[model samples]
Target chain A: MKRDLFIIMFISSILIFPMTVEEIFDKVDENMVYKNMKFTARMNILEYNENRELSMDIFMRDENNILIEILASSSGHTNRFMKKNDQMWLYIPNAGKAIRIKGHMLKEGFMGSDFSYEDMSENRKTNDLYNMELLSKDTLYIIKLTAKSSDAPYKMKMVYIKKDIFIPIREEIYSSSERLLKELIINEYKKIGEKYIPINILMYDKLKQNSRTEIVYEDIKMNAGIDDKYFQKSYFER
Target chain B: MKKIFLFLIIIPYIIFALRFSGEYNYNYYYYQSLNAYGENRVILNMNADKGIASFHLQGLGQFYIGGPKYIIPYPDNIPNYVIDNLPSYYQLSNSMKINTAYLSIYYLGFNLKFGKFPMKWGISQTYAPADIFSSTSPMDYSYIEEGILGFLGMYSFGDNTISFIYQDHTDYEQTKQGLLFENINNYFTASLFSAHFFNTRRIFNGFVFRTNTVEYLLSGFNIITDYWGPGIWIEIDYFADVEYWIQDSIADYSHYFLIAGVDYTFNDLLYTSLEYIYYSEGKTDGFTYNDILRRYLNDNFLISKHYLIPIIGINQGETISGEFAAMINANDLSSMIMTSLIYQPREYLSMDLNSSFVIGNLGKDFYGLPPIYTFQLKFYY
Candidate 1:
């Protein structure tokens, strides 16, 4: 009987010691967050009977500042978007000046893609914004997250994470009214240094019919030593 | 001639390190006045960019049929003195012309620019009192700003910057130098500009202020709490000992011009803005038609005593967008309304349909202007 009790206690400790949902999220954030990063990406926006592709170069500093520039396009013009803290600005080559953009504009589609400006702008830590719970244990760990604040882009999200990698494989975003808004599926991921990053992300807007945006990241470098000058509004012209 | 040769020599070096890009645009327009007229235009834009150096060149070719004699008004024969002093590269022709050619270099956190390029100052998008460099053509709806031949140097620090610009207009026997200081912070942004004109013996100074704030509950979004909010901007320009050609003589005066504007967006789908401008130097009364014409021709003063502008825009996802803008001359009770529809069938191709209507008494502001409808096809490479 004493041996049986010992085995049961050992099993209980084993269950209790496994990382909690909150801890798992923290781990994920730690792996993903960076001081600065630079990457080149191609966005393929697919709609019914049509497809559009654009190339962009992105520089991100800390978690609040981001600068994006459209690579040379057929139109012979370059457009830039910069987000510093709470302010966002857009610069068009012809406009000759950067125009301040409202925060609500962050909810709209980015350059006619499924990704909204808010989705691309802020890099909030999952553990800070959402309350996570383990939904199931299988080849992949399914987790359900409820937003802690109404300011979040989505009220609820269901994420499927790889058990060993601590990275999300798929996610479903729901609005406050409990309507499914978007679905993001990670098609491919590359191990860069010590972190796992999604190289190809396919996002679908559930409200839109026959539409999807595929973002493929290439030549991504973390801790890229980007200068602070890049975060300034004047840098938009550069 | 020496400057042209210097530019030519630098062109190959810029091209060697540059990546080239640009677009071709074609537009057709029909106008209804006493007689119907049609205008066709094609524009080519080229840009060559290296790491810290770049060049932009634009060429425009146009043809008109039917109504008006000229699609774009040609400057009445420039005085011989003005022509003789003009830059050799400056050319005026009947059909085609090079619209812009400029080179810019960025070195050691300092930006140096030369040639002809658009220089913008002020916070207001529609009417900027501090924008003393280039005067926008009242009749032109294309919003294609003409370049100013100048040199500019700028240095930036944190969220602030200081720039100096020296503009050369030898043809007019005038030169302008301006100093501008700008700062941006979390709550507000402001700019101060001061310009001195040598030939006119006038000094112009102005300041632009803008603030943006978000109202969490007022935005009416259930999930998104931080809406874009409302933006308010004001600009005021003060001229010291300005001279204006009125009736046939020069009138010297010191006055202030002001512009105030507000803009907001709804749920990121709709946008609306309103602006009011007060021109202190504008003619109040006792101005004859020929006097107005002469002042515009000789001194290039186009401001009215009071002006009101309203603009609205709607975006339907990524496929369609529409905009309506109106400029109302409050004093004369005249207005011009412009409406445009943009459709993107594909990622790199877009079609624009635009229309303009003028309303008021004949010979009044925007009253005698003809109605215009335009269709444009743009392709990006």
Candidate 2:
């Protein structure tokens, strides 16, 4: 009994210094936010012994703009998804039309993948819209975040952040009623310039059986000096 | 022809950024107590994108096999009086067409396009009153994208755009000019448009017998938004100065079309929506002369006053999805329910099956034709 008590006290002494939620999230922002980023990725979706693959080149500028150009598909037709200023537009090359999507539609799976448009959208500055609390401190900083804004993608999120690197290694997303919706794990990261970024990720929908999506980034470039013209509709048509 | 041939040969050498794509689609339609048909369609497209300019050329080839042919020979036995009116086998034909050929230029703040291209604009899936250019045939919806010859120009400023279009109908008197303004934002997409046709024709007994040289006006507004939890859309269109030209007498009047709807999605996997539509050109009790004439000229979906549509769609996995819909004519309680399924085993191959049930009297004004069941196989390269 005395040995057990001593072990507990020893662990407590090591935890005398603790990190604040604000400080941790500020570090997170540093690792996540960027001026311009370009990445080429391949997504593999597996369900019921069947697999589907999609190849895309994603470009992002600032917090509100992202363009996903689907490079390869079965029909060899080019399609695009662009998010600018809280609005999403889907461009079909065959139709020559850009259809504006809605909020709930953003929550649907993108191209039959496990990733939602909400998940593909650039979500930055976690400290701004979420009430953050550090849940525990050990090998990792366990944190809980409840959304403070109505337009937040998820009602609540639990983050498992790696130490020193300030990058989240895993996350559990929950709905408003506290139901677990999806679980995401970052499998690998690459040290690019001064920051560490996730390069391989896996997401599973808790509501489905034997459903999984794996996203592997083939190439990633940070602060690549991407032009604003590439984010416009005319440029997308070209 | 010589110039086009020269351009096609030389341009391929000059432009290294050219892409070629084609599709072959075969659809078989069968119905009871009606003629069965099979159609084979092939489309080939060549596209070039260089700097601020782009070009697209599409060629289509279609073959109608066993035209108006049926597997079941009429009836086993019929009275001589009924046998005299039996249907005859129709001859099959084949044709090739240049579906679309357009050149688009984007420079500074202006977007310019000239040639023959399909005009696609609408909000709702089934009934979009603002889509006055070309409409889709829901029953036989294969290779049905129609393009008109036109020149279009548009200028954009921030969140708003203004466009002008001029469509040619082989002569100056049959030309059409239009202008449109739109503002797209995070919450709502709204547009106001107007088109004026220099001349239109009159249809009688399923044929456009003569042309009327009177100006006609078509105008509309469309607004779509995501309101709180569900998506809501509303569209309104007006037709003015329509000339009937019956018995060498001119009958002029106006008509209106309206549509409003809302949709909700469940867990991002299931989609559901309900819609209500109103057509002013139709009668509440029955179809009018204006309604029948509009149906002959334009391939309008509904001919009666009120309609309600409920649709549900589900995507279970990466490769499979299905949609079921019911369009009901509120005036007579007649309805059509349809379901379509698509399966893609590979990126280059797909098979589709669609079946529908029509529940109404055989003499209804619209959607009274025998329902067509379709099985199609498509290949792409």
lDDT of 2 at B138: 55
Candidate 1 DockQ category?
A: acceptable
Predicted candidate 2 versus true structure: per-residue lDDT over A171-193, tens digit per residue: 99998788998999999988899
Write one digit per residue (lDDT tens) for candidate 1, span B1-381.
Answer: 338635843674456444444444566656664234344556666666678876766666666655433232212333445334323232223377666667777765677777766777655566555566775544555446666777788788888878888878654335677887777666666777777653332121112212211111000000111233477777777765533422232444556677787787765678898888788767544434433343333343444688888999888765688999988878876788889999986656798999988786644644445688878877665
Real interface contacts reproduced by model 1, as a fraction: 0.25
Across B192-307, the per-residue lDDT of candidate 2 in tens digits comes to: 99987743544443332444455568788988776466778898887776454333435665677888999887766688999988988666654544454455444555678888
TM agreement with the true structure for every prediction: 0.78, 0.79
Q: Score candidate 1 by DockQ.
A: 0.34
Off by over 4 Å in 1: A1-25, A44-55, A74-76, A103-113, A126-158, A173-182, A205-212, B5-10, B17-21, B65-94, B198-228, B242-251, B283-304, B330-333, B362-366
lDDT of each: 0.68, 0.73
Worst ten in a row by lDDT for model 1 chain A? A70-79
What are the chain A TM-scores of the candidates, in order? 0.89, 0.89
